[model samples]
Target: MSSSNEKRALSPDPAVAAPVGEVAVSVVEAPVAKKAKIEDDGKTGEEVQTETQEVKIDARDARDHGIARVKAEFRVPKSDYTVTDTVPSRDNDDESELNGREDTSRRQKRERGQNKNRKFGKAHDVIRLCEAIKDGGVCSHGDQCKYEHDLSKYIASKPEDLSGTCPVYEAIGYCPAGVKCRWMYSHWSKESNKSLVDEAKKAAAGREMNRIDRSEQLLLQRKKFPTPKSDLILPYLESVKEDNIARNGGNGGVPMTNEERADNAATYIEAPIKPGEKKRLNYSHAKILSPLTTVGNLPFRRLCREFGANVTYSEMALALPLLQGTKPEWALPRTHTDEIGGFGVQIAAPKPWQAIKATEALVEYCEVSAGGLSEINLNCGCPIDLVYRSGAGSALLDAQTKMLRMLKGMNAVSGEVPITVKLRMGTRDKTPIAKKLVQRLVREGDVAAITLHGRSRQQRYTRLADWQYISETAQIARDTFHEVEDKNKDGPERAPVWFIGNGDCYSWKDWWDAVDNYNVDSVMIARGALIKPWIFEEIDAKQYLDKTATERLEMIKRFAHLGLEHWGSDEYGINNCRRFLCEFLSFSCRYVPVGILETLPPRLQDRPEKWKGRNELETLLGSGDYRDWIKISEMVLGPCHENFEFQPKHKSNAYEQG
Candidate 1:
């Protein structure tokens, strides 16, 4: 078994024994509970025993109490359940339903982890309004349209308006959902049967960029979208591959002579574009939010931006889906107005052709004139099993020659949009290959930047990021750059490739340490940003801010409001917002309040034991239970639908009952 799995298999301390099959072993030693002492009553002269209540201790306090390790817990028990009752029993109906397993027997036998087949059903209105009626535009179908034409009937049948004003209308001066909006009463007139619009606000509202036009999408779907640049670059890449094969004795198993090799080199075609010609990128000391999958949606990016994230990347979109003109894939590149100057579109491809074409499409559609794309990032570090098995993501690390070709082709057709690559240490744990890759990246690949996530594909988040290895690699990249520059003194001036280190950077100290000590240009934050959206602010202040529970809730409210504006103010939108909110909370709840922390900088892996917050609201915000996350969502997005369900992507998020 792998070290990570072995770590999980180890049992907790027997002395502090929890219920069978419920205890999760912590790497950190458990803090010994203080013993209660007997006290004498002054008036009665009778001895009285003092009751022992739960005591809260911070990192410092835990250490002061002779504890050698931080008392951390990945899975937390609900408020009603004692620490011993952390994980719920299979017999619990509520737990089973929330876990998406209705049968108790199935729940008992099944191992806890990702809910791969979880279903999300959209909420639909009983009487759907016609697009013509909603937008005041003519419908081509006219009377043939199945949608309701009578605004009165549609409004009457619509569910009662949600409380409070419409966030979308409040922000942009008009609700796109119109009368069908959940909060329509805030912007609708009963007598006039018309939706109100703030003409001035609507006109002044900043439009989101990179929305794929219907015509462009249609062209892509028909495989007619012009990829003139890719057409040229792909043939050149293939010719180079053929030449390499010939030189390596592929010509009837006979190796080419020196004369033949020279001839082959002379016949090699020059690339359409050079590294120096690409747009310059300066990410020095920048705080970047990593391209998270489902949790890193636009609303969350917007929140991080408000909190001072220097750069944000879109979720990794698959090249196949993007080329096929799938709406979901197309949506990955969509950026909010605030993200225009700092946004990057990350794509994953298994082949050179796919990478080249995908880059061309992104550059063509998401042009600078249309919002803009800072860079095209090739994702080579995703550790998901499905992506890895498909010969993409981290699998690229194993296929370096193919990977280098993909990068080269991407650079050729990317125009001014610089192509960057995100990578891992290697495919397997303890086998670091990035140091060697860095030399090749500088000498051959014309990438704008290189981001090395300090973990191997096999390590995942099971171990701490290897910043020492990342530092060594960064140094190698610098030395390689100098060597290459000296070798090509007469060549065009190229920008120095920025090196970014990612993984386990949870605090300002972590960020600064990577920059100051590790020789990295920047640190890409993933889980850290999810847990504390205001982490950038902390970096700026160079100190931890003890955010009140109210302040945190307000942030949650802002995210929900932004989600509504981006997704829509309709039932489906609300459901999406609620579900994503829960997803965010799943990570956010892992944050141990700085105010309660006895230590200055908290490590990402140091999971705190069950501890109360300064207040009830703070405790709720720090809850590990998915149900509490829903309660927090209800406070903002309103109650979820009866069929609404959420299962955390990590198995450790749920606990078993005692």
Candidate 2:
């Protein structure tokens, strides 16, 4: 029998064991929580079908308060419900359904976009008259071909190439789509009956494999993704499991005493790394970007990198999917060519088995030697309902022992790759447990870094982050790290765990203040980065930039160009680019220009009153309407496809679209 599955000789007395399932919190009946007051338009509210708010503000009072407070206000426009051309509206007959209703449905639902259900376009029955077909051979279909078989007929029907050079062909030397691609004429030479392919690029293509490189294709195809030490670690985990079963009288739900738990953990878990094996990460004062879902793709990370972000993380990949050899999950680890050393791949897993296996796969499939990643981050702070429901994201914060086991298992399997974690304050508002959690993380998790987002899971994005609590927790983390360091003096010299503060960091002032006053190793920006990707630039310069609308447009244009390059310049790619571009604009539009803002440091919670920009483009940039976002994307990506639809992730500011 395997060491892990072997029956223990001595079973512990059942009387001493409690339920091993996480310590269940008592469900006390509590009064219904009252809703917080609406501070901004981003709050939940319906379009006033029978009324519109009219405000009168004194210019002198506005200048004094830094915000225009309502001097006199009344509801107007009681006749018809206003609706945009792009947004669907209720018919006049159905207007009564909207009367006196809470209209919780007004918040826009999340969008998966064109890329989610993408399929390659239909392939021609007979191959086109390319050089390969011209070599006196039948088309790949051989017989029963529907397309024109004669080269002359095919050549005659082909359209002329008006769209300059094929950007993909020019860079890669070969067009994989060949004649089927819309831009075929750009690369094809009718006179020579050949492609004007670059020899150097052709040779380079043969050498590159993987998304980032072509040479690793063989390794990937063979499913050779395995960490060298995974075998050792897997058995150890099994032994731990066996011990737990033996000690708990075969019940996985039976909880052991602290001593019993420690004894089992010590038997299986080794130090995260050897004396010199840990990878050192310099996150101190780093301009770090959060791993924003959907919005944080490779092209966007490249854009952020160009704009001066020192560190960028991939969108969180689920562990089970990664272990199952899923392409989509694997793709999450693919980084930009430029993000060689500071790119981290974040993963979410509920159990040790998933965590360990996924970590092993990442270490094996994406080697740091191949510029695959810098670190593996455990995402424990995501408050999204879907993630939270999976007992992964913020749920890990509630299951402290489960979290510790998962982290230890991940570290053991990840080989040299340092492990980091992102955390929220706690699951509930009344209980802020991050400080206590930090002490536990220091003692058992063996993590290389910890990032604390200063909010409870319940708060999500409703209120401004409590930076004071973040500061307090950071101080606690620092103290705990010192204590752990002193205690582990005789052991391997692992790198000091870096502590980063994340939440509502929109400007250079916010970042610097957190690092300077809160004593955090660094600050991570999420919505702030999406709104103004160049916030890193501002941090580097240590000053707020009064970027003109034209300058901001240039940034958008750069994103469009980069998007086309990364996603490819084909129709499918163009549509995906436009979709993602719109997603970006949804956040980017929230930036109220620094020059026009009354306050020196703009509060993310404050909503601007109806105001025109210094320029038309600036006004367009700050528009809250989702259709305006599509309009801005059209400026660069060209008009979105007729079938295209965009839904902002933020429901609070979304227009009604069914």
Candidate 3:
């Protein structure tokens, strides 16, 4: 919104707020919400009808107040009641039976119209609350909302819903739909026109809401998971012309040139893992949710070796494929001896049987010290609708019954590997029942830990994460678990399990801030590392260090070789390997150029393209042979290929629709 517009809205009497700027007219009608939002295919959001609303403002009042207040409004046209769909409309001159009923219907329709208009005009409070709830929708980062307006659709769909209360209000202390709340449109709108000006008395203060930290003696009889968190080298040689201009002043005294502007716009990402920590994780009551998505197919065991990541999880593996034992994709990648020795394999199961049967064979593969893994991670966090509708991923959040069934079955066989579930905020907006669900999972389901993804399934990855709510949930976890501990003092220290945070981790600074700011155990990464592989190394080094073109090429070469070694040497396999390796290179190679790059230890971002390959990439880039990448994947995953064909299992963005 424009500053002037905001100023007008703050007018003492919003009705008098001013309208500014040229108004935009839309011909497309508002969409109506389909009752059945999801079907066999997938979830297609609601559809609403739209009718034009011509709002007229009093020029004098608006100019004084400085903002515009909605005057008149339009509604998306309602479906016509006709003879074919329902009964014949009174428009038909059918005499006898229909005559009297037509008049009655007319009266009812008039009354409904009056109620709707009155409701829309007064729709503010509940609508604001609904707005808050929608605003609270998860962003890639946490839930400290800085936005003023989010989730406009829910509000825009309903013309009169803005005035009243709804279920969302009761659950979240506010509504998100604004004036469009269901209650607002329902015929129960209320408005208070007069107040006694505080009875001529002064206003008084009130107590603030208190947030108590309650992590004492908790035992929610649940399982837990381990959570964990780097940079870039440039490929080009220094750009001397740009460098000189940046150092001196620019032409016409512009702060930056077009070239500089282009460079500034390029996207960058940080590493996923925080390295150089003081100790290894205590996995006694912890499960590792891995192989993390930092560096593609980068093994958990290797991460443990490099950064003391005591526990590691396999990337989410499909239960059906893994159970079939023919899974070659990384989404359902297998765990090696080293990783299994440290942590239990995480399984993404849509049904209870998948969780049930997989646990049986999975346990045999794990060889932990006698008792085995600390916990088995149930992948309830996947947002992919493919898994959700079947009671897997975040979809599990909506189906409490199915979730309980899956957890119960998994718990039955969890001799050494306790069953734990990871869930997002809920299936959609206003579903704060995650706390309630967590309670159920602990009490009836008997799971171990509840790692809450601070987003709702509705969010996918669009909005900011709600950290405040995560902390609130954490406090709830502590309170619930602690009470259980007090009741059952003999049960091991009533450990409150652990609360893990995810999303928007771009740098060590972000990781430290989250830990210090939110008291989370660990965080998971996916896209952040896709653009920067050296983040872990940077964390361990403790200081910012830029890598030169030559240094980065070496890392690239090493990664290529690792890929080749892991996949093997066949032409087709190696080419596929090279393409994937190049994709990684394309992103990771983008470091800050010149002046910015020079801020660190080495100077490389400014370097020219000729400086790209350490030895020379002219041969490698055009050759299309990735003997180098396979070698790198091999070093990371270990040897493979009898027919000289490279095969890698770990993968993401798997739809590959084309």
* Candidate maximizing lDDT: 1
What overall lDDT goes with each candidate model?
A: 0.78, 0.68, 0.43
What does candidate 3's lDDT look like per residue over 1-658, in tens digits? 1111111111112133234522222122112223435444564443434343422222232222322112122111223221111222223425513542233334221101111121101112222322233323334433554433444554454333223223333323332332333343332222421111222222231111111112210110111111110002111112323444555766534355678656753432222211111112343322233344324453323333343344555566676664554335323333433343455457778776666656654554444344235467787778876777766777777677667766665555544456667878887867667778776665552565667777888888665677777767766776776666677776434234656666655444444555667756665433444444444443443323334444445565555544433343223334444545644643343333111211112211122221122223321331211233344434432342222332222221111100
Candidate 2 C-alpha lDDT tens digits along 1-658: 1111111211112122223321211211112223333436545332222112322222233333334221122111223223232222212313523431234334334333223343322223233444345423356676655555576576566444325566567656766545534466776666765556677887774222125233343444456655556655666666666666667687655656778768766766464565237778899999899999989988799899998988999999998877666667767787766787798999998877778777877876675776567889999988988889989999999997778777877787777888899999999999989999998887763788999998999999777788899888888877887887789789866577789999888878788889999889999999999988988877875556667788788889888766766766655566778888888888888776654544345655555554556657776887766667777987876655544666555433532221
**Candidate 1 per-residue lDDT over residues 80-140, each given as its tens digit:** 3332222343236476455543332222332467666655656877888887777444568
Worst 10 residues of 3 by lDDT: 222-231
Per-model TM values vs. the true structure:
0.84, 0.73, 0.46
Candidates 1 and 3: which is better by lDDT?
Answer: 1
Q: Candidate 1: TM-score?
A: 0.84
What's the candidate order when arranged by decreasing TM-score? 1, 2, 3
Best first by lDDT, ranked = 1, 2, 3
